[model samples]
Target: MGQLQLEEELGKGNYGTVKRVLHKPTNVYMAMKEIRLELDEAKLNGIIMELDILHRAAAPEIVDFYGAFFIESCVYYCMEHMDAGSMDKLEAEGVPEDVLGRIAGAMVRGLKFLKDEMQIIHRDVKPTNVLVNTKGQVKLCDFGVSGQLEKSLAKTNIGCQSYMAPERIKGESTGNLGTYTVSSDVWSLGLAMIEMGLGHYPYPPETYANVFAQLTAIVHGDAPELPEERFSESARDFVSRCLHKLPGSRATYAQLLSHPYLVEDRNRDVDMVGWVKRALESRAEKQVQQQRERNQQVLEQQQQGYQP
Candidate 1:
């Protein structure tokens, strides 16, 4: 590794900024995430934890952490560069059904790697944390809010508000969050799928006050009304299973990969669902209008007969 020529700023976060850099020696592009370690000791610890976990995870779906160094109080981490950028970018461009299926498969594989293989719980599994490459391959990123579970029951609030599992939001662990389990990640993954397809947070609130109120409701009430039929049937079912309110009811990553919707050609199945739903909705509206028109005609006929 030689001098890295900084080209452009990729992104910025609360604790750090990621910049696109070209290594002069290899002429390869990489992302350099620079974190100011001295800003807050607690924040620094979180970054360090993320770095350590990423290093421990050499799985294919996880972006490789190449190297790291400290310049004064600033910590810089060099990781594999994704040319295609984040899932948010893909969602903005509108992904096709096949591409969405591929993405879903990749994410489930990543979750399997994290949960079964590494035993690391990725508390945050949102779309923004998933990166895509030129080949449309998806990689999981951003471990700042992630934590390794040691017990079977965890009673702490973590992860992004929108992606947080219902139990986690309540800061009450009715399930096994103490140990690194895939259930919590599955819930977040479902939210990620919804966000990617919808182009916004599924449970977005009008204001911050509304957000808290909604989270509280989510913790105690049923899951939000997910716009499932808006996507393919397979995709809808996959996400629906992931969003199951009970953690144990959610599909495991491996189970998701083998799901009929993910592995098979579901063009006919999904399309039929889409077409039929729209037709039924339209027919219902037409029937209502026709009933009103029939009533009006009857009223006019009665009035005309009386007048004659």
Candidate 2:
């Protein structure tokens, strides 16, 4: 523990919390996820699945793994550190369609690799799990919930509820309940693309009183689309393809990669490094401004002899 110098806490989830850590001997920086080994099936599955995939999968679209070991009740594993962080932290304003298309292309390629080579389905495919680096690299991370296909179907719902497809939400009332297909991942991809496009969740979570209401809207409501005025026709069509109500109608990874929306920008010379740099700078400046305001308020309160 002492040799692994801890840095800022990246994020935490149901299974584990990821931290930026440095190995003193080699001075290597990596993202280490410290997961508590609870004697439960879900947690056990997550730990085993993540470690298995991370160790075997080697692609530009996937995060690189260093190693993993168990210490006491927690299992700590190291992997790539995405310097620019995840898509959730990126600036949404002025993020044009081309940039988004590039991200989608990379993600699709990553998902394709998992599907074709590893026979795995990433149950969770949200913005937070898609990591981006300052070098213009966008790779998929967090594979704990990923599942191997058995006859092209995984019968479990171990993913984010808000990003679940209508079939996933229903569970099994429709006969295929608990049965999941790759199309379910497509639905999640559409939602993630919108979140990156709009800087927030596509679904109106606030309007709904509860999770069920939000899910009901997802199941029964019309599919979401990017505003015509804000996005191009190709973009709108592409999202529609992924968010189809019927899983069979949804575009597969190969089809989506061939879609004009993604292919058009695949080779375009987008200054991703510059875009990510600017976004990080903007976030840092905003944080500084917020801190300044807070300090000023504190100083004023002290001068006025305010008591709490």
Candidate 3:
């Protein structure tokens, strides 16, 4: 790639700071993820692993990789710009069932490809890692914590705690970190689905004061499920199948693809573009309101500080 014109900063992630960039010659917009290798020796391996997976995962359901450039102290990679942004950036008012179904189907397909073709496990499968485009295409991104399966299980205890399966959390409490199977990913899928559906974390971390209590709740309490009366039976059942506490009982990616909820959504005429546009618009409005409230508070504080 030639000289690129940098746009606004996208956001910082575990690996690096992502920024919007324009490829000068091609006039193409790309999300440039810049990773500083000088920060940590382990980052070198993490960057390499992510690059390998991104380079190999050429499926439409996965984020497209453009290229990477490594300087003396850092590496910068360009990837497809997701205009609709991540699923987490959408309005917190909750996602439509149809849109959720679309995202779920796409994510499962991407995960299945990683598992079946490469025997890789996405150790982290949270809402923030799922990306959507204006074209209504949903894809999975960020392979930082992804790892190859060892004896049908991943041993690393990396990833979001709230989305962790009961076995993983319980194992963490003990000396051992539980072996991660594909079903562990399925548990994350259920959590991600519920999070996007409710527009918030299903198990809100702030509600619990003690960290041990939070882990205990995840390990001992009943697994999270969708609101039965609020959602369709098929939708509720699909989430139930994914949230099974016993990893073996959880539905595989293949089984998830065949779920009635996803199947029905697939057959219908969906207006995903409209749904996403509306959500983004709402989010923008909410952000402006929040900014105004912050400014108001600042003015009020200044007024109180004035000496009579």
Candidate with the greatest lDDT versus the true structure: 2
Tens-digit lDDT track of model 2 for 1-308: 76789999988866579999998888988899887765566756666766877799999999998888888777788899998898877845645687888898989999999999888788778887899888999999876443322112133332233678888777543556455778999999998888788777778667788766777788899988777888899998998899998889999999998999887886689988988898899889888999999999999989889665
lDDT per residue (tens digit) for residues 17-41 in model 3: 9999999988999999886655455
**Least lDDT summed over 10 consecutive residues: which range in candidate 3?**
145-154
Q: Candidate 2: lDDT of 48?
A: 73
Model 3 steric clash pairs: none
Q: Model 3 TM-score?
A: 0.90
Task: Report the error of model 1 at residue 266, Å.
Answer: 11
Which scores higher on lDDT, 1 or 3?
A: 3
Candidate 1 wrong stretches, greater than 4 Å: 39-52, 144-161, 172-181, 207-209, 224-229, 265-308
Q: Tell me the lDDT of candidate 2.
A: 0.80
Candidate 1 local lDDT, 1-308, one digit each (tens):
24889989988865579999988888878899886654466766666676777788887788877777778888788888986677764464244455567677777878788777666677768777788665445688865333432122232322234677876654434454343346878888888777776666666665436555767666666664335456667667877898888888988776887788677633323342343244345545767999999999999999999994
Q: Write the candidate numbers in order of decreasing lDDT.
A: 2, 3, 1
Question: By TM-score, highest first, what's the ranking?
Answer: 3, 2, 1
